[model samples]
Target: MANSTAKKNILNKIKQALDTPVPLPFELNNEAVNVFQPAKEELEIIFAEAFTKLQGKFIFCADENELHAQLQLLISSKEWMKIFCNEDQWNVLYSNTLNLESCDAAITGCEYLVARTGTIVMSAAQQSGRTVSVYAPIHICIAFTNQLVYDIKDALQFFKEKYIAIPSLITFASGPSRTADIEKTLVTGVHGPKEVYLFLVDKTA
Candidate 1:
């Protein structure tokens, strides 16, 4: 009975919310705000551009196998040779060459990257180490285009109802971690990766 009543209350709240209309300013009666829906290609272009503006970069892959191959390339890339990893780990393939001080970036796969707010969601797991994404000057994430969502609420809802396991650490990363820690000067890459790159795998079948 208690559970039934709780469910009923939730339904009622939802109904009321649906019935409620957003308040409008009194300046002009019946004035409406236009919401432009971005097309698929347009959204991609915008997403990529927005990512670039926020110091984000990306590398495209064809499929899961390609993603793995590309990841291997990234893991051993001369560009980021200063970083380390544990080859024994499932997703971590290069643990032997990490330079703690020189390390300034991370790489991880995401369940999805929310498009509405331009935030990426990464869950903590054995292979998806927290350090790989947080302990660096830059972060690189890969996800398919289909995994993109509109908002955080949708992301959490999908996780709760489908994925079922709540992550020990769920991070909503929008951009590089920055803070005005010392005096008044602004600084970047102090607490976390200062650059983030999202590669959307659209060619996957």
Candidate 2:
């Protein structure tokens, strides 16, 4: 019996790792996110405020199809070298998001966006190196409105039910990487990115 249980557990983990993402059964509503809106009126206010706080600004474009120009600023930054992406977006910003030499300051996209606490889950893969998201001085993540869920509970449920694909690794990041590890002294840019910026762009449905 013990062996059978152990085998079951192993199989469950394997299934989770190899399963394709399954679409969630629950619909996102104000009931789940409370602030969810068709116009995202309040959300726009939050976006403005939070976006202003991002340091050394960078952009992770959710729509690389040359649809949004808000990313022009980031694309033109003097420090903006190049973005690393799985696919090439030729003319949107004249960018070549490939061959990331360092994770010092790079941005990536997220699959599942949690609205409750403003968290995004990143599953490490070839395009998105495991270290690229956490090892950089600043990490920026872009997510679509439809991708956002209420919280981690809903996010995990969706993952378990849907994407059972074997993800090499999984990470749940809320804000930047921080810790009061040294004498309770608050420090930034310690273990990972001193700052984490999330951009939520909703679709016009």
Candidate 3:
């Protein structure tokens, strides 16, 4: 009986609190605030430095031809025969080059490249989908200069403007997956790819 009475009192207090909702303790500011200083170098340069610092391999291509040549060279040098790319557009470019049940590397396109944080923004809306990026032992991204954004906020704004209804999944990949959980010893590629490569094609050039 006593326990029931206590439960009733708790329910009544919750109802009362909901009925008399309190305002936020502080006033909310809607003004836009700049948290970081403006970037001094070009977005591409900034992205390259930041990405390389995170142990990502960066390649700059002047055009699609260069990108193709570089990709071929990397494949030959690394001896990666089973390349996987499901995108029709990319498949057309690298015709007769990509086809394998099991892949040594996976190539994908990203929605945006965040320069400030050196991040790759991807969504379920892309043709490659989610698994292509994380499943492969080596993940390679093909990106254009036009897809570069100054910051994550810019990427979010781009998403807001591009999609009326946002995608179900949005992911940000910085570099090869790593963890320092076990014995505080840093280990890479435990959760995802061991190596990550970004080939940035300069469409503006």
Best by lDDT: 3
lDDT of each: 0.66, 0.59, 0.90
Q: Which 10-residue span in candidate 1 carries the lowest summed lDDT? A: 85-94
Per-residue lDDT over 73-169 for candidate 1, one digit per residue giving the tens place of the 0 to 100 score: 7656746655444324333553434564566445566766776557778777436556677876667676777777665666887788755678787
State TM-scores per candidate. 0.61, 0.59, 0.84
Candidate 3 local lDDT, 112-155, one digit each (tens): 99999899999999988878899889999999999999899999
RMSD of 3: 3.0
RMSD of each: 10.2, 11.9, 3.0
Query: Which regions of candidate 1 deviate over 4 angstroms?
Result: 1-43, 62-78, 85-105, 181-185
CA lDDT of 192 in candidate 1?
85
Ordered by lDDT, highest first, the candidates read 3, 1, 2
Supply the global lDDT for candidate 2.
0.59
